[model samples]
Target chain A: MTTMAERTRTTSGAPGGTRTLTLGKAVNEGLRAAMRRDDKVMLMGEDIGPLGGVFRVTDGLQAEFGEQRVVDTPLAESGIVGTAVGLAMRGYRPVCEIQFDGFVFPAFNQITTQLAKMHNRTRGAVELPVVIRIPYGGGIGAVEHHSESPEALFAHTAGLRVVSPSTPQDAYTMIQEAIACPDPVLFFEPKGRYWAKGEVDLDAEIGSSTLDAARVVRAGTDVTLVAYGPSVETALKTADALAQEGRSAEVIDLRAVSPMDTATVVTSVRRTGRCVVVHEAPVFFGAGAEIAARVTEECFYALEAPVLRVGGFHTPYPVAKHEHDYLPSVDRVLDAVDRAFAH
Target chain B: MTTTNGSNEAIPTLQLLDPEGRRVTTRGTKGYRDRAATLTAEDLRGMYRDMVLTRRFDDEATSLQRQGELALYAPSRGQEAAQVGSAYALRPRDFVFPSYREHGVLQVRGIDTVDRLRFFRGSDHGGWNPYEHNAQVYTVVIGAHALHAVGYAMGVQRDGTPLDAHDGTAVITYFGDGATSQGDVNEAMVYATVNQAPVVFFLQNNQWAISEPTTRQTRTPLYRRGEAFGMPSLRVDGNDVLAVYAATQEALERARRGEGPSFIEAFTYRMGAHTTSDDPTRYRTTDQEEVWRRRDPIDRLAALLRAEKELDDDYVAEVQQSADELGVRLRAGVRALDGGAPVSTFDDVYATPHGVVASERAWYEAYEAGDPPADQYAIAETAQGGAR
Candidate 1:
């Protein structure tokens, strides 16, 4: 195992200048940068102020930005978004922090209705432009509602834009970009990847990352692995493992859950002729469902099997011992991949 | 719009036009209806116009929903007088928080008719702005809108807007009788009272919650419930647009004077189903609807208008025709909703995924070779149908 400092950057990555950043540090930088540039950018959520958030992404922000900007709200999700809506209406760009993924249900109505529709209803009269910062996805050995991958719920809404960044760079850049967007955005930061560190160009404009585009993490010719938010890392590892087994794999990180980068997924499927998507949400209905449907229509002739998905089981996220089973692990991903090839 | 106040010197019940359509002069009163002498005949005519137009839009939107255009529609069929009369009384600066209903109020506030249906149609969450129309989004969660309205009124208090609107800019929240049972509504009253927020808690007691009768929502009358919270409460004949207008106008003025919150329960009936999916016959009776139908606010007002020469048979026909044309525009608007869904990627609950979701998002990418979504049809069909 290499030390954090000794970890190598992806040299064979895209021709663009490569930088290695842990998912956590990227988000931290994104927040710091957003706040540094715009005094209107404020962060508020439980444990976000002096404590730097439960996960510590906003760890040093309070001291740096002061309590007025890095606010620590009570343990109330609805209250947080509700107040933030008020603040935003007052022209303050609030970057709300939701401690856990599943904990977002309490604020679901606020996000889905008020936050999502405010712009359209107002006829763009009010651009909430508020960012709901959430640490989503499964694992972390948590309880019910705490381990949900409920991105589909937000994506199901029309007016709200939902995005998840996979890499440390994406984590950092997307946060700023999300805050800078004119519409309400639910920015899901991969909590597990918080410790993963990489380089972030302090001078880069964070909004450069399109809030609605998909990114291809790795290129392969035989099969395409599609995922987003926290699943990008797993998809990469799975791709590497598949390579050892002589199966070529392409990994696509669907950074935006709504207005899905359907073209990217279809392009890959049209070329590779096989597809396997992975998500941490229950398999019954997740982002994979949307991806599979679109691919079948656009690239039906290219598909050898029905779009295969590796996701959480039908039941609730199980206890720790069975969590590995509940989550779509590398093995499960590959198993699905194997099934796709078998077809 | 005439309000709920004694037009005559002695009687207690509010009056604008008697059932016989004659203007009964109030000998003398300080309330707004008494001040009706200050308004020219044109002001009365304009109020009538707003009430009629709002009803037209409301009826058209309902028909669109019935025709399978909107995902869901909450008809202000019988509550038009309660909503519009109050809305028309307010100045532009006054903010309003409305429950899932209030199609009439939105119209009076100058919100586009088709825009209101964007949410119920499932194409967008809301197509109107709170600031522009001075009305908040149509809150679907019962009684929750009251809290937001109260909070906004608190903001209004903080900003000195309530006290500054000398001409009477105040916050008014419209909710149904059934919503009075929600804890949020109670808490909202508490906040509004304690903070002395310049707000009006307008409860349109539309006598039913889906299939449940008003009796199910309250053991005591909703208007009296406000007195418990130290608010001046009144139960007006909601079917009378004139009464609702006068009462709401007085309340809005009082609020603007920093007089704190007031509760006005517009006693009306849910003439139509709670929503299009509702079958009043299932839990209620058509006979009950028929009884309320004769007391129709529109008819009652039209009868008065005829007696006053404010409207003739030809004018009535013209208004109905104009409403039908407006309905056509609203139908076109509903059809124009964007066909495209949003981006497909995890919005990550917030800015980031908490823990393993990161690796999971990464792992998800590893399992696939091409950009193929898993089950797009299920998402479109299920989510799309929910609003409908």
Candidate 2:
């Protein structure tokens, strides 16, 4: 299932200086741009070179940059990330890719214990400017191990900057920003939205926003719906459906998960007075719990009701046949929104 | 190019000097002796002094830990020859990544005893700058830094440095036999060989991985495992300083020659507990300890020096005097340390400032200053740029 065709041409957006591309292709352009700008940028991952990538996100990178820059590594996840750590220490910006979400655990020790702590452990003598890209969250009809959300695990880590992108423009811009960061960044790509097309300008201004800031995707006043990665679209859809029912739900896309832009989130929650969190990961100890805790403490007086959560059950991501039920959908987000209104 | 027996199978071990301190010229070790002979009597005496001082420092640190002056100590008592010999073969520019027990290696790299002891004294994570000494900080997690070394070597190669040249620009990483079982180590071998990275994997098999013996850690010989990854592998008489030095020198030469990675399994024993927290008596027998004691690296080196008429009473007294001075300085330095600022914890979490960490630091400061619970969150909220 490898595609050899190189689609290098950019498509124009509707009446704007932007281009419409899939989230995966936007990421491909972002990587290409980053490599073009910096000679020190290198890519390493399994099936990322000749085969482009499992999702074709790295299509034609190896051919354009040569195998030295875009390497097709062995099927060892820990090896990929660990080597990236060394390369970073040696003054190279290595952008590593973990093929699947569940496969990231093999490299967890290196990521959490070594890469995350190297800067702090060395007392700021060394900066690990490495970006670990993982295709996370479920909604695609993929089997187990292929689709999962382990963002919370990395977010819980102290030294790592965890972020996820919900749209093509974000996927394109954030990937480049994460690469330039001096600290180690865990960039979670929502695999389910890889094929979702949106407008992203190839020549857009760089560094327009720090990769860690949250954005208000859709504005309303009655209540706020918070989500990231795969769940952001569902929350927006819930807002659209809620508007018909006169609920006027505000949706916040939490692009940065770790040094979480709780300021923006708390600002929206204060205005809306009610909040509902949506996520595909299990609710217990997931990003929802963190958002709920932060909103409660920051907007204690402004909150009209207790925050509600709509997310996957506390179990492993199910088989393809039942994945739709396993993932947080528009109805699920709306149900949580309804619960917040009822309270 | 490690020496092999005539049978077309690799020799299980290469010992240039036997335990009795006599240089051996057997078929398996014959080639290395000539390399070892390049070192003069003065050079050998330096190695002896290094091993002796390192051991004395280790002993004093262990006692300091027991006396509650330090948190804990990983003694490099019996493994000094392995650490010192291999480290002596490296140039100042060659990058070195070490596991926690490479105090001897640190000493060889000119790491100040005070800065090194601060880590064990609970005053610092790793006090010395790695870049300052061409050595990375102590990596406690086993086999993790092997990948770092390989990556660094790969970077060296990418920078257009000729691999085969003796330009004093190679990489060497040290880990224990127990780290062999780690996936990162195995993955590091794969990357090193595939990229033909200019690096050497020095495995100090000190017999025990804490409570487990070398046998429990691996079934076959640890050096042979490197062969499976297509790396040139050899086992050395770790306690024999000359043998280890020769093996490491050859390994470094091979790495510099653009010959990918080399693995040196320094066969030795840990004469003390794994750390200050372990009790060796519960896991090892006295007979086993006695067998390794007869092969003490320092004793064997001392015997070799004495037989050659190089270690006279005056030299012994001078070395003793230096070791005594080292102990006095280490004790005074540790006591003089202020244990650093308590708020320094909020520093270095990220190279760039982070909103979350800043808020948490503010909250911690307010709490430490006896702010009530409500005011602490208010301070954190203000610090994080949240609207109150």
Candidate 3:
């Protein structure tokens, strides 16, 4: 399968003018584009209207779309998601925003039991194209219950498509794709990378195929580094550090976590014969573990060593002071890469 | 039993018919009585037919479970009026979100008998098309569908349908007394009232949620909980079919007029076990069950019809014959149901193709085809000797 980056390179002859946008603004623009494209698309969340969300990811949306479309629901997370299910049943595409990752437990039952299984439970008679956008991961030195990486919890559930965007371009296209898709998507916005800017072409057309495929952001042959969301940046930085040491590293950005694009990582690992998976969630039963297991099974003959993982320790996101040590850093990813090489 | 207001004034329960099946009106029930008086004998007989058929369905399902033909069955034997009466009041355009054990409503909605039992038969989670009857499949989780009903009402509000129009859509959701304590139910009431969504919360206070009594679920009347949310709320004799029908019709009409949601606490009793797997004998006294048995919903309705000369032995025999035919059909159809191929489990998981599901399905198919693994890692037969 061709990566999205490769598809973009091959398809774009004379693309629209590119503009630098923060990851948050890219998502905002993507939401706006989707709402404009379909009248059925509406956003529901607390403080998203007028307040533009805590991170300003949904800034100015309620103003552009009427209040009826961009609804500011009551201060109830389960209410937001549960009602969105109803709205979806009525032929509306609802995009809900959970304020923070830690606050998502209130809506966990609705998301998992209702939204995730509605279509399958109905035997495909009902299509709930609800996008639950959650600002996740620890960064910016936030308080307790504000910083968390709960992607694996959702990724483990069937009938849910979990995806995270590492760049503004992917965020811009993927959010729109997720809204258009008929399945319920848990769009985990990397809170740490909300302000990270990248050039996004406004006129670029993204196919649905690219929504679940991983991309080779930076290529090499010594070892493959697989990461997603906030940890993708860490993997790239680790590759740069490895380059200075004369050890090449291939960096892969796994956009979708649930229906993981394992084939791309497997291809890269088969060539490199070594692999390390990275994420900001705890190493115990994290998305990295799934990637590691898949890499080992598929690339067993090509493997020169066991696949390694770099992620959070098995503890609550520590106090703000110790978060840098708690989250996966470039150094930790490099250490995992070194371990893979040593093996 | 009477409820009290803040000033300690007694609030009478709404009742259009007494336990003896006599047409009697209380002060609070006069308006509802006038509404029920408008129904013709034909409509009354139709309701009687539905109630009798629903009870028969419940009995047949319980027998099926006893015979191991069904995995489980939740009987709707005593709450027939609470379910059938309210369902009779809905228009074709109105939607319904029913919790599990709403077999009476499903019957009124014309859900296939075999289709209704499929969930209990362990063949499928939901067995019927929701849109076909403007009713959703049974939601097993308590109080969750209340929010869905309110949300659907909100969607109706946005659809530009004239709220005052007779054809305008409304929504009704049914749950038990036990669900009133759930946070989702409270949250649903909050959303419903605040949005003024066109929905009705039909609570069947069947005296017991399994072994737990209504007292354990609430200190105040369940309708008072809806009043707390600022909706017009009332309590009714759930055994009285006319009372339930009148109350639900008024509420549905109010909803269509955009007056907002209303809550009705149908005071009834669960005369049978919660499910076939449950033993109600272990919890409640038989004396209490005997008291409710005298106030049976189907018996009261049948007596009321017989006294008014609207029902006779011929009509009763016809109804019995139809119910017997329905039971036979349910038994034959349910037993003949095929769960379909095992590989079909992977189908419809996602509307779009998914890589993980596809790969896993492929692996499963290969395994089913008896293909040997390239790298088989298995414990040797000798390892079984170490088992505890």
Model 2 Cα lDDT, one tens digit per residue, A1-343? 0010111122221123678899999999889888887778899999999899999999999999998899898889888988898888788889999999999999999999999999888888888988999999887788779988999899999999999999999998788878877789999999989999999987764562457788899999999998999889999888889989988988999998888888888889889999999988889999889999999988989998899898878888899899988788888777777778787
Per-residue error for B296 in candidate 2, Å, reads: 1.6
Order of the predicted models by DockQ, top scorer first:
2, 3, 1
Tens digit of per-residue lDDT, candidate 3, span B158-257 = 8978877377788999999999999899999989998999999999989788888876887776788989999999898888899899999999999999
Model 1, residue A110: displacement in angstroms? Answer: 4.9
Chain A TM-score of model 3 versus the true structure?
0.95
Q: How many backbone clashes does candidate 2 have?
A: 3
Model 2 misplaced regions, further than 4 Å? A1-17, B1-11, B28-30, B372-378, B385-388
Worst lDDT run of 10 residues, candidate 1 chain A, spans: A1-10
Candidate 2 local Cα displacement, residue A161, angstroms: 0.7
* Model 2: per-residue Cα lDDT over B1-388, one tens digit each: 2323212455467776778888777775666888799889998889989999999999899888988998999999899999999998998788999999999999899999988887888888877888999999898888999999999988877777765546747899999989999989999999999998889999998878999877677767789888999999988888888888998988898888777889999988899999999999998899978988998989888888899899999999999999999999998888777667788898899876677888888877777888746744466557766311
Where is model 2 chain B poorest over a 10-residue stretch in terms of lDDT?
B1-10
On lDDT, the candidate that comes out on top is 3
Poorest 10 consecutive residues by lDDT, candidate 2 chain A: A1-10
Is candidate 1 or 3 superior in lDDT? 3
Ranking by TM-score: 3, 2, 1
Better of 1 and 2 by TM-score: 2
